[model samples]
Target chain A: MNLYGVRAIYKFEMARMRRTIMQSVLAPVITTSLYFVVFGSAIGSRMGAIENISYGAYIIPGLVMLSLLMQSISNASFGIYMPKFSGTIYEVLSAPVSYAEIVLGYVGAAATKSVILGVIILITARFFVDYHVLHPFWMLSFLVLTAVTFSLFGFIIGIWADGFEKLQIVPMMVVTPLVFLGGTFYSIDMLPQVWQTISLFNPVVYLISGFRWAFYGVSDVHVGISVGMTVVFLAACMATVWWIFKTGYRLRS
Target chain B: MQPDISVKHLNKVYGGGFQALKDVNLEIYPGEIFALLGPNGAGKTTLISIICGIVNKTDGEIRAAGHNIVTDYRSAREAIGLVPQELHTDAFERVWDAVSFSRGLFGKPPKPSHIEKVLKDLSLWDKRNNRIMSLSGGMKRRVMIAKALSHEPRILFLDEPTAGVDVELRRDMWEMVRKLRENGTTIILTTHYIEEAEEMADRIGVIREGEIILVEEKNQLMSKLGKKELRLQLQNPLDKVPGELTLEPVELSEDGYELIYTFDAQEQQAGVARLLRTLGELDIEYRDLQTRESSLEEIFVGLVHE
Candidate 1:
């Protein structure tokens, strides 16, 4: 099983995180704090509740989702990419470890980091506004599932990217826009019928809706549909990762 | 006794249709230092990479420490440690952590005492807490060795171990190689530095253009191809060889001030005495004479050129 090898990779990544605490942990925490200050306190104080939930509390799950997605992708991608960049990947490839262990180590650590960040942000929301976990178990489950799924997706991005700019392109250009347009701030219900129908096409919509449902018990989409959508995306990422390792794409010659 | 490492019918063809190795067959016994010598693009690195399980081979069989490299990769890989030709390191990592990490990567349980001993042996104990990026090039090379040794593999492949290092570092590395061999570790090193092979290898294998042309005991290869040259400085110039010598006129150098005779080093005594007697019989007086032995470098050059 090469469990020691897996633990080595996991510890190495966690050490890297600790070494760059400011960039890894504090930066997102501070950035999300600003969102709390501006959107949750200042703007939401004037805005009315959208569906029996205060506007301040309504945005908590959405904001947590935004940070979770970005952080997970970056952590996992950068984790795998650094070895290739520094030419130390040969050590990992030559070790007595399986591809599954490799993925588990990198993705597991990345997911753990994002989940921790998600929890910290949720705690920070307590100071900004009041919110409750209508289903705490479901909330934690969604947090972990989303983190693991996105981290796997990020691992693929790391393998596919040839340059540093490519690493940033997808996360910034594709993900941020989808999260914004997928109703991170406002409900899609406020949009026209055609716009709401189009919103369903954005995968982030289901993720946010299911996560929001775990918090407020009210969601733009049914919780089961959102869960099903997230599971499908997770499986797709898993298949892609499996294929990448099987073919030795960008990893071996 | 069984071989410590063996490769049979190894062939590697890259995706672009470039064949890097062809029908390579080799066996390295336990507790021996075998040097693979070749020029650039001769598949030295590729051969080592495949045997270490880093690069996949198109066709072949390889066994390390009694385990097949592909079918039972985990144990095979665990039996070997590779110090690549290039100095690749995790720059931000501390020496202590990086060495321990390598040990763990081989599925070994944490053995701080072993890690400490490896670091101390490599003279890296004092720098254990320092980041790798802060070290000098030689120290980085040392750290690479430390990492490779941290796992205590039965076989070690040092690809160009002393390349691009200073004279002192090269000497230290040579000494270390001897010490490791004395410890009963089978070491396979690939290098173009003929002197390194001449100085370190118990057996030498020469690879040229993706093919292993020769492998022999160091002394045997030297004796088989070794040549000695004798040169004489004549007191007077000769337009030709005087046409009176028993040997051909090819022995005379241009301008005719000196004569050179190349012979087998092992039987040089008899040949040189007879040649000098003939020269005296011809009344060819010489002011000075010198003998030179061909180095391994010349033999290597000749083999590669052929």
Candidate 2:
């Protein structure tokens, strides 16, 4: 209801992103570009195509998803965590703003940043590899949906984490390993029969598979199921955030 | 006029079963400075936090500016400006942006001239463009005050506004508080320094063991509880107080060189005159007499101990 309050928080967070442009925007772009050079060019030359698509172009969507997921979570988590750490959260909590507005402001800005990074990585990919968007509308939709879902997850993580070390634990120990194992570089069909079954259980696989489908119309899982799983995760994160605010968990005492 | 803030039967019990506040009741009048005096862990901060809607109360009903704090939190919160005890600000933010943003958080439209006035009043106009991290400690505290005032709320809660501040800033803060009061803002502050309470508070409340032990007008509390002492130097040593002087609460110094009389300041004329008359009738000789009135600090210490 308070649009000005939301705008103020959103602008402040976006300004922080602008202030730390190198770390926030450039680092992810450069890191993903290196993935293209090493995995797309060096390794793809040896391996043949999958589904008649060039190996270099096959990994573009996966690489963009990798960066998008990490950046979304990191941006949203750090945005909320810094306020908690510095005790400025008291100001926001005591103000006239509602919990919904606070979440929207922070998560919206974080998703905006992630989507921008995703698009930039996609453009950067065009220079190194040949790729096409079979469904441009679905590609944009998946990009936005993934960014928003992961950003919500990061918001919960920010509230749940009590220390800086805990903030990095999830992104480092869990998310990064899952991204690598989710067929970012190769198809899951190449794995052993049993390993392929286990890869289906990894949630990141659905995200990458669906995003890759948007790019070249080839996927390890049906695109409909991937979209359904993303929506389910988004709803779950939304429910968790609602519970956190309702119980004043880690926010009030 | 109705009280600006009214709290009744307020109680707060933490998760570990530690009761931070117990059956507390208070009513703060509009346009007056009320000082909540308590030692560390006495729940001063808890009380303020609850009224501001930051902490959830275990059980209580509180109304701020005629709105229930729980049921109508938005309107109640909009009427209050809280300068918390901790000095926390966005380190990378410029002073102007921080203050403007705070105003917007209260759903107030941008008033650049008003922001400029507040900054000038706090002497932070020159540093408006500087990052908060680059300012001095005193200046940062001022910025906190500036942020609190940005929305121009009807009531202001300054929790230990002068803690860790130097003498100059302390004086400036007091002056600013007075100016705000003149402009019709009710102020409530908590402090460990009795001197601060004495210097500014129109009324005083002392909290101990999670309960408000006393609340009274500053002058009335002083006259009612404050005691005065009269010390008389004897020209010659005496072994004991004379029989006539025994009716008064008089004591002979251990060395038998002086007599000390303690009496309420409110009854100073009658009690001291009677004591002097008794001394004259007894032919007691004294070289000199000195009188001292107990300060608010002494009264506060006595009340807390009691």
Residue pairs in clash, model 1: none
> Given candidate 2, what's the lDDT at residue A216?
86
Cα lDDT of candidate 2 equals 0.94
Which pairs clash in model 2?
none
DockQ versus reference, model 2: 0.83
lDDT by residue for model 1 (A158-237), tens:
88988899899999999999999988898999999999999999999999999999998989999999999999999999
lDDT, candidate 2, at A58: 93
TM-score of chain A of each: 0.99, 0.98
- The TM-score values for the models, in the order shown, are 0.97, 0.97
lDDT of 1 by residue, B1-306 (tens): 788889999999999999999999999999999999899999999999998877889998999998999899999999899999899999999999999999998899999999999998888999999999999999999999999999999899999998989999999989989999999999999887889999999999999999999999988888788888889999998777666564632388888999888887666377788788888988989999998988888988989899
Error of 2 at A5 (Å): 1.3
lDDT by residue for model 2 over B20-121, one digit each (tens)? 999999999899999999889989999999999889999989999999998988899999999999999999999999999999888898999999999999
Listed in order, the DockQ scores are: 0.87, 0.83
Provide the overall lDDT of each model, using Cα atoms, as 2-decimal numbers.
0.92, 0.94
Q: Which candidate's lDDT is highest? A: 2
